[model samples]
Target: MKIYSYPSHVKQDIKEFIEKRLDSGTFGLLVQGDEDTIEDVKDLMFDQDDVTGNGSGSYTFNTLKAEECLVGNWDLLREAKEELQPNVDLIEKGPEFCDVMIRCYLLDWCFNKALAEIVNNTETVQKGDN
Candidate 1:
């Protein structure tokens, strides 16, 4: 299958923020919304490992952000910026990615994407209501 590679325009800090989270081991970005009846709280936990499992009734990009789900973690967004100070990790590797100032804006999008398709065929999903 095709993997989701970072767009060439993606800034280095954003890449590092996402990649750092990827390296942080198994984590799921719990996305919640109102669908079906809009009264029921629909919850779908997108595992970093499960993003690769875009098959069947399991998690797909369509389901991740679909259902008009307004999902995002304010703390993660803040931490992403604070946790990794001064983008040194990427610089040490070499000339890191350079581009526009879209990093902060796309941090939430990185949860399911960017981290998707990196792993092979994984087909399990965790969905619930809360």
Candidate 2:
């Protein structure tokens, strides 16, 4: 997602703002701005937060009048992400945790499939006996 904070022409503030949010553990994905002039005001919202599980805040980059920063609360972002991918706790540390999650998901899928197959086989055997 791309965030357009007012003063898209003010590159420094936009970059600084995003970096601060990232360092604050507000997002997992990296943000990039400064698309135009170094002084151009703009902010880039990257992939949704992974570890933090947050969504992009709202904002308008270019407007006729001086625009107020439409910042989305971090809590709301967290809620939104949770709704989508709530199984994994976003606060877990590092890539190892992510790997564990993946493994868990795969195991769950396999277990479910095996259970279904067993049920089908059992039903078949019962019908044959009858």
The number of the candidate with the highest lDDT is: 2
Give the alpha carbon lDDT tens digit for every residue of 7-124 in model 1. Answer: 3223233334344643332223212221331111111212222321112222223533322221233333344335444453433322111101113234335533433432221222
Ten-residue stretch with the least lDDT total in model 2: 51-60
lDDT score, candidate 1: 0.29
Candidate 2 lDDT for residue 17: 42
Candidate 2 per-residue lDDT, tens place, 35-96, comes to 24212211122212221111322122132211222233234334434544576564553333
Q: Report lDDT per candidate.
A: 0.29, 0.32
Candidate 1 lDDT score at position 73: 36
* Superposed Cα deviation of residue 59, candidate 1 (Å): 32
Stretches of model 1 off by over 4 angstroms after superposition? 1-6, 9-101, 121-130
Q: What shift in Å separates residue 54 of candidate 2 from its native position after superposition?
A: 26
lDDT (C-alpha) at residue 3 in model 1: 29
